[model samples]
Target: MDIELITNILFAMVRSGTPLLLVALGEVVCEKSGVLNLGQEGMMLMGAVTGFIVALTTGSLALGVLAAMLAGVLMSALFGMIALGLRANQVATGLALTIFGAGLSAFIGADFVGKPLVGFAPIAIPVLSDIPVIGPALFQQDILVYLSLVLLVLVWLFFRVTRAGLIVKAIGENPWSAVTLGLPVLRVRWLAVAFGGALAGMGGAYLSLAYTPLWAEGMTAGRGWIALSLVVFASWRIGRILLGAWLFGLASILHLVFQGMGVDMSSNLLATLPYLATIVVLVILSSKQSRIRLMAPMSLGKPFHPAG
Candidate 1:
């Protein structure tokens, strides 16, 4: 491909990956705290619809993004009350949250379907953006894209260099031991869940406010689920998560590349690339069961009972 084509493809890859990076980052934190939340898809949908509506009605993208994050937090709080507070089945509760969010967001967003609103504009760095092919792809992006990169670094630092990160890791590994050591296991778990929800919401907001810049039912298109898989694919490491997200993003945009090259293929089948990749990753990971067990948080998906 020519320099311009390469640049465009690279740029698209980053844009496509940003939402996954955001959601997966949050999930890494949540799972690290020993909570397995399957409600990310639902949270993302709610965030997308809520953000779109707020931005469209109020003409303020900031409020829309904030509203989206709040919507996700609310959904997560519901999950926490049942799964964490009542010690309900985490998987079942998470699935229920997804169903609920999907229905509610669709209902609320029905009126605003296809309505137009201006989305986030790309900001190019002065000197950096003028460089070669890599520069345009890396330096020219919307504010959220840059924010995602910053969040990735911060999250890595949070896990590698901070006391709170150690506490969360300890909780995930052995909540009982953490409790015995006088750690606030329940409180820390709640906070982690909330943080995951906020980021999931932000990811959804990016979809509505910047990525597609429009509202549609199920716009997340299983990106949330992909994000969940990405956490595993990255082995819960922040740096690997970035690479994995971009790979998936590249997978997602292959259809566009093919179309541009005048390649004949079914659009529907092409659209399934990302999901297909997800299944393949899961299968490969499943085969290495021992490795996964070694890397995964021991207390993951298990309800914590402090009194017991």
Candidate 2:
């Protein structure tokens, strides 16, 4: 491919990856605190529909974003109440939340179907964007894209160089010990879940408000599940999450690239690439169970009972 074609592909890759990066980053933090939330897809749909409605009605993207985050937090709170508070099965609760979010979003968004709004536009950094190939792809992006990159660094630092990060890690590894040591294990996990919800919501918002700029039921198109897989694919490492998200993003957009190149492949089959990659990654990782055990949070998905 020519330089221009390569640059455009890179740009599209980053754009495609932004939502995945956001959701996966949050999942890392949530899982780090020993909570396994499978409800990210639900949270994201709630965010997307809520954001689109708020922005369309109020004509303010800022409010829309905040609303989307709030919607996600609310959905997560519901998940937490059942899974964390009531000590229900985490996996079941998460699946239920996804179903609920999907149904509710569809019901609420029925009126807004096919509606259009002005979505987020890219802003170019003057000097940096003027660079040859990489600049535009990296520097000229929508606000959410920049925020995702910044959050990636902040999250890495949060786990690497902060006391709170250590506390989260400690809780994830051994919540019983954390409680014995007088640490607030329950509270920490709750906060982690909430944070995850917020980011998931924001990821959804990016889809409706920036990525596609329209309200459509099921618009996330399994990106939420992909984000969940990405957390595993990255081995819960913050830096690896970015790499994985972008790689998946490239896979997601390959159909468009192939079509541009005049390749006569089945569009339907090409669309399956991202999901197929998810399954393949899980299979590979599952085969190396020992390695995954070493990398994953020790108490993940296990309910805690303080009275024990």
Q: What are the runs in model 2 whose C-alpha is more than 4 Å off? A: 263-289, 292-294
lDDT of all predictions, in order shown? 0.91, 0.92
Global local distance difference test of model 1: 0.91
Top-scoring candidate (lDDT): 2
Residues 133-246 of candidate 1 have per-residue lDDT tens digits of: 889778999998999999999999999999999999999989999999999999999999999999999999999999999999999988899999889877778899999999
Q: Give TM per candidate.
A: 0.93, 0.94
Residue lDDT tens for model 2, 170-202 = 999899999999999999999999999999999
- Local distance difference test, candidate 2: 0.92
* Residue 162 miss distance in model 1 (angstroms): 0.3
Clashing pairs in 2: none
Report how far residue 38 has shifted in candidate 2, in Å. Answer: 0.7
Measured with C-alpha atoms, the lDDT of residue 150 in candidate 1 is 96
